[model samples]
Target: MLLEKINGPDDIKKLEISQLQTLADETRSALINKLSKAGGHQGPNLGVVELTVAIHYVFDSPKDKIVFDVSHQCYPHKILTGRKKAYLDEAHFHDVTGFTNPNESEHDMFIVGHTSTTVSLALGLAKGRDLNGRSENVIALIGDGSLSGGEALEALDYAGEYDRNLIIIVNDNDQSIAENHGGLYKTLKKLRETNGNAEDNLFRAMGLDYRYLEAGHDTAKLVELFESVKNIDHPIVLHIHTTKGKGLPYAEKDRERWHAGGPFNIEDGSPLYPYQGEENVIFSCLKELLDTNKNAIVLNAATPMGLGFVQGVREEYVKRGQFIDVGIAEENAVAMTSGIAKNGGTAVFGTFAPFFQRTYDQMSHDVCLNDSPATFLIMSPGVFGSDSNTHLALCDIQMFAHIPNLIYLAPSSNEEFVQMFRYATTQKQHPVAIRVVNTLRTTGVDDNTDYSVLKSKIEQSGSKIALIAVSGLLTMALEVAEKVKEQTGNDITVINPRFVSGVDEELLVSLKKDHRFVITIEDGELMGGYGQNIAAFYGDSDMRVRCYGISKAFHTEFKAEELLDQHGISVEKLTKEIIAALRSE
Candidate 1:
């Protein structure tokens, strides 16, 4: 096989121009063959096979660095860069990551998983190269969807002025995880329609030379384009239009659904494990809010589907101007939500917890400082969220908890989430952030707790020992209480601290009257987490405090249960520890 013979970019360069297309076809086949079972970014990777092959064939990789924005499209790049076995061999499927890693290969310039970072990163490489008197070409490959991000636009504005050998390849698949948004996308559509002859060119306006290639999948033409800009003195933007999910018929027809998913049937594109059509609680709450309140709106950066606002379900609300997708711009989304709230409109912005890292500055300055009553839902935080080191949001509490004028609520059950959501939207006092659990634990009852008064609820009352469970770990806390009761004939107190931002001074002081041991178990980082607040609250008291949480580290590819167990958060371990503490006293 052509792919088997190919080991690296050097091997691809050894092949004749006529054989490059054959190699690209092989690379795509290998990528599909693996992802059909393992599942990953199918559409992005499938679309970039030819472009990656052409880039590798024309440019000297390790010397001439190539940075892939988001790196979701780097599977084809990985297959050609001495990592084909990970795609071709089933046993080796677990060998490589879905994104580019500098640790994995020298061909990979950065370990990037976030979007809209390539241009800036490539600019740094170019600047360093110039400073060191090196002349290696620095290339940045970014998708059209990522172009909507503030960072990419800022970098593009600067790259236009930098006089150096830098190549910017705009892979215009015309889609983000969903359909593209923003006025920039309209400019892109115009450029594509006119075949880059339009007078209103975003790239040229930035002061950079531009070229257009319509046949993006044609390996030879892509190679020609790359060759022309190989060692150019000035920075250039190569705008190439390509189809997302190029070779797969099903993926091509439904681009959004094929962005990323689990293993599927290759023949009919049926999921291997069919979706059970579970109720999306988040979307149901949003629908209820929008249906009742005309002034209420929901906003997401680029991940509309993350809040369960899929293509079919979101269109009607979007038409009503109640649903807004800012398109890969989380910073802008946060600031806009603050504005929406200040103007007496109910605004809720949510995305994956990791993505919230980008909006810390805006969340602090624009939202919290202004005390805008904007509701922000932090989705899938702690050990249960995205397990990649690049995407681990173990610091959500650290980022949001201590911010003044912000009330951060951690709901342990579905009913509580609903209650918190209602309270957050209706209240006009402080900015609210709800840390949504990955799995919804149903209580089958309504939560009518008056959150205006910050307090802790004692789920079960006992003497001597108290367990303060944070959000998702409440279930484990209950189990530990049960085990301790059965084993030691003592019922341990279980406290659910609904609020993370502030300690319930009344409730905490009440605990010190009867409770000797206050153990806080959280699902995030041990340092600067919810547990630490409890520890700090009792620093000068007779009450002994112990905080259990995941250690400070970029932990990845781990089972939530196992990671918790390592932190002594398991029912068996905690029960024994509590029993021992009880016995010692």
Candidate 2:
């Protein structure tokens, strides 16, 4: 009832501390109920409800720019900022996104989905405001897990030197998709225990003012803390202690499991959906390699769960000193993996596709330049790209495909992924990056393929037009090809170019004789992607090429299918385009 009456931050500002707690309670319920049915980030949003409410009550958002790191916690902020109906009602669930978006509202400063970017973006806003002779407060709400990231650390070091009005809120819930790793967490634990009196403070070491709050959920204390920094002329770090899954008993007991998941039962917090079976292609392959090879090691950057190496799987490798969780320090992880590989150890770094963006230079210079035989398992690349802009890995192909000596393989099936993972771990030729799109339906394991060859496989041989689809986009292309054949009775050649980085020169040279028009489909960006390289390869040749992928722009808050369709990558769209090209010829 109280939630219905509240419309905006002004309404929240009008409320007393007692009423604010009631508001936080209702907001958490709304979040949990919506996430139960619609399936969005549950634990993070639930934990940040009170903190978000307190910030809105204390700070003048839009005027006082508040940037949420990774922005998963922005759901509660969104609800308070005239967007409650979106999450409270099922019909309006699709209205707002899971992350912060400037396009969605004036309150949201950036369309961020990646971790550890808030500090830098917020600092820039603060600098710009000062330059323009404006005096609006700038706040960055960053998580503890994000602190280990190179960019965040870089920005923190910069912020410490800059004499300006900036407030950095460290939401120390002590988990990051998985349990937090790295030495910084130890510092945070000490700071929390000592109630801000801890010596050797990391924030102070970075040259910033520091304050600690043991009770993050207490709205009165949070408001007081914000008031203290409201008129401050220097950057400061407000470390707030909070629980990852604050309200729910089940979630609080196991923070990692409740981080983010599908629809679940409200009573006992059990998943409503059943398990779709183990992602054994990655897990089994990695397990076998680590088991046999004593010198081989696996690495993850704060996301061991995403790589399907959670719990028992991670512990087994970690005990052997082979599983390294570098927390959010992706740059460090990449370089360390390279060092291990160079020193005659088999090093494989597995991380989500988007996070790998932070390590591009290291993967290219530190690893690829030296030609280290490190294996990179890039999980969930392309259109299977999840949630918000911060999480979408749509530009991975553009980033990795151009790097020389980096063999990027896009596995078509589970069997293909298994074979490729095996090859990547075994081979000493160059760094191999497996572009794992999704957990494909197991087609009974086959270990016959030699991934070392690194060639394109022709799924269906035909004439005139060649459909070169990369990785996960293959299924969509195949569906389009089927429709084209039914309508026009023309058999179009479908080739799965597994290796996106290297030009399958032998395959391309052979295609010149048979195909006249070539169409390349990729799940990443069109500009500087695998498709463009193919287009460039045939620039002076007889074959005319049309590349289909995401355009060079920041696409935000879109369903996977909608994004694909918008980019002319859907089955109907691709089929029409191919037919038109055929007709034009």
Candidate 3:
């Protein structure tokens, strides 16, 4: 096979033009094979096969330094950069992560999973190269979808005036996670239709030299385009139009659904592994909120499907102006939500917890300072979220709870979340943040607890020992309580602190009278988290305190079980620790 001969970029440079085409086909097949077995960014890798091949064939990596925006399209790059074994062999499928990782290979410059950060990062690399008095091709491969990001736009504006050898390749797949948004996308469509000869070219207007290729999938054309700009003295933008899911008919037909997913069958494109969870309460609450509340609206950055508002499902509401997607700009969406709530319209914005980290300033200034009464749903936070270090959002409490006038609630059950959502939208008091953990277990009873009270719930009141649990960790606390009852022949108090923003002073004071030792457990980092408040509250008092949580670090590919156990939040560990503490007293 042509792929066997291609161990690295050196092998690709030795190939003839026709052999290069065969190599592209083989690389695509290998991508499909591994993705079918292990699953990954499907549409992105499939589309970038030719582009990656051409780039490796044209430029020298490691020395040349090509960076991929978001790095979802790095699969083909990995295959060309001496890592094709991971794709061809099923056992080695998980040898590398889906995104760019410097630990995995020398070709990958940065470990990136977030979107639209390529230009700025690449600009930094270019500046470093100049500082060292070295001249090597510095390229940033970004997509049209990423152009809407504030970082990419700022970098593009700066690149226009940057008098250096920097190449910016805009891979115009014409689709983001969903269909493209904003006027720039319309300009891209026009450029594609006009064969890059449109009036008022976007690149040229930005003060950068511009060139567009209609056939981005054409390897020979792409290689020639790359060769034309290599080692050039000035910055340039190469606009290339390509298909999102190039070879797969199903993926091409529904680019959004097939963008990224679990392993699927090659025969009929059905999922090999079923979804691991049942119906989520978050989306159901969102759907009902939009259905009943006419004055209410929902907004997302670029992840509508993450909120269960898939393409056709949200069409009617979108037409009614009840749903808005602001593309990949989280900061804009956050500020816009504040504006919406300020104007007497109910606005709820949702995004993954890690992505929401981008809007910390906007959330603190625009929403909390103005007291906009907007509802921000932080999805899949803590150690239970994505295992990737790039997307780990362990410091949400560190981010949200500290902000003044912001009520950051951690709902312990499905019913609590529903009631919390109701309370957040109905009131006009303060901005609210809800940390929806990886899973929501139900109590099978309706929760009408008044969240405005901001008090912890005591599941079992007892003397000598008190266990204070945060949100999702309440289950573990309860398990530890049961173990304590079974082994120690003593009842331990278990308190679920639903609110993380601040301590319920009355509740903590009440515990001091009866409880001797307090143990606080959370699913997030130990420092600056919900548990610390409890520890500090008993600092000057006779009640000895212990805080258990995941330590401060960018932990990746970790199981919640292992993380919890290591942090001393596990049932067995906590139970024994509780017994030992009581015995000492």
Candidate 4:
């Protein structure tokens, strides 16, 4: 009842410390209830409930810009800023997003989903405000997990030298999506224990003023801390220690499991949805390889869990000195994998799709150029997967496909992924990239596919139009093909181009004889993607090529299916387009 009456930050500012605690409690209830039904970043948002409330109470939002790192914790901020109905009410829950969105409100400055960008973006905004002679404060709320990232560290270094009104809040819940890894976490632990007296303080070393608070959830103390640095004429770091999954006991015990998920039972916190089933072929293959080959090593950039080697899996390999968590430094991870590979050790680096963007140079020069034979498991690539722009991997094809000596493989099934992983690890010929889909139903451990050949597969044979689908878009393409068949009575050639980096020239040339129109569908960006290459390959030829993929702009806060349909990648859209093209002829 109190929450519904409050509309904005002004309403929060009017509340006393006692009321603020009540507000925090209500916010937590709203968050847990919503996430229990809609499924989202539960722990992160729950942990930051008090902190976000304190922030809105202390600072003037929309004017005093607050940037949330990764923005997963912005759910609380959304609740306080006239968006409570979106989360509290079931019918309106879909109205709000999981991350901060500039389109959603003036309060949200940037569309952030990936980690380690808040500091840099905040600094730029602060600099712009200074240039225009505006006195509004700029605050960047970052997490301890994100601090390990190269970009965040770089921004922290930059903020250190530039003297301006900037407040950086380090939300030290002590866990990333998984347990926080890296040397900086050690420093954070020391700072937490000693109350800011830690030697070799990371923030201080970067030349920014540092202050620590042990109880981050205390509204009065947090308000006082913010008041101390609200109008400070220089950059400062406010290190506040808080408990992740604070209100939930089960979540508190195992922070990683409760990081994000679907609806769960409110009584015992048991997941309402059935377990997604863990058939981790990639990690199993890696484990087998490591068991057989002593010289093989694995590397991850802050997301070891994404690669199938979670905490327990990682420890098994780490004991053998084959697994390394290189923190959020992706560039370093790529280079390190290259080094290990070149030094006669079989090396494989695994990370989330968007995070790999940080290692373009290293992936190209250190790994591909040298032809180190390092294996890269690019997890959750293409548009059908992660809906958030900051986390979307739509540009991976554009980035990796052009690289020479790089062999990129997109597996349609889990069986294929396992085979490719094994082949990539054993082969010493060239650097290999596996564009991993989020969910791939295993077809009962069949190692029939030979990845060494590196060619495309025709899922369905036909005569006229050729439908080339890549990675996760295979199913969509097949559905479109069925619709095409119903409309024209002609079976369209549905080909799954499992490899995107290189063109299957032989297959393309062969199709030109019968297929008049070629439609390339990918769950990545249309610009410089696998589709473009197909278009360019048939530039002089008579084949009419149309590419369907995500657009060139940054797309955020969308359902995967809705986004695909919006991009004209649905079964009906593709079928209709094909019929029209045939009729025009």
Give the Cα lDDT of each candidate.
0.93, 0.86, 0.90, 0.87
**In candidate 1, how many Å is residue 127 off?**
0.9
Best candidate according to TM-score: 1
The Cα error of candidate 2 at residue 540, in Å, is 3.0
Candidate 1 TM-score, C-alpha based = 0.99
Models sorted by lDDT, best on top: 1, 3, 4, 2
Residues 327-392, candidate 3, lDDT per residue (tens digit)?
999999999999999999999999999999999999999999999999999999988888889899
Which sections of candidate 2 miss by over 4 Å? 439-442, 445-447, 476-491, 565-585
After TM-score superposition, the amount by which residue 88's alpha carbon in candidate 3 deviates from its true location, in angstroms, is: 1.4
The C-alpha TM-scores of every prediction are 0.99, 0.93, 0.98, 0.92
Off by over 4 Å in 3: none
> Candidate 4: misplaced stretches above 4 Å?
439-449, 460-462, 476-492, 557-562, 565-585
lDDT of 2 by residue, 1-585 (tens): 789978888888888877888999998888987888888877788888889988988889879999999888889999999899988899999898888877778889888888889999999999899889999999999994899888898999999899989999999998888888978889988898899888969999989999999999988888888888896899999999888878889988888888788888989998899797765567778888888999999998888887778876688678889899988889999999999999999999988887888888998999999999999988888777664566678888888878889998888878888888888988998999999887354558684778878789898887889999888777777788899999888889999887888778888888888789999988888888888888999999988898888877666667778887888888998899888877886
Q: Where does candidate 3 clash, by residue pair?
A: none
What's the best-to-worst order under TM-score?
1, 3, 2, 4
lDDT of 1 by residue, 1-585 (tens): 788889988999989999999998889899889989999999999999999999999999899999999999999999988999999899999889989998899999888889999999999999999999999999999994999999999999999889989999999999999999999899999999999999889999999999999999999999998988889999999999999999999999999999999999899889999888668888889989999999999999889998989999899999999999999999999999999999999999999999999999999999999999999999999999988987999899999999999999999999999999999999999999999978658889999998888888999999999999999899989989999999889988999999999998888898888899999999899999998999899999999999999999888879999999999989989998999998997
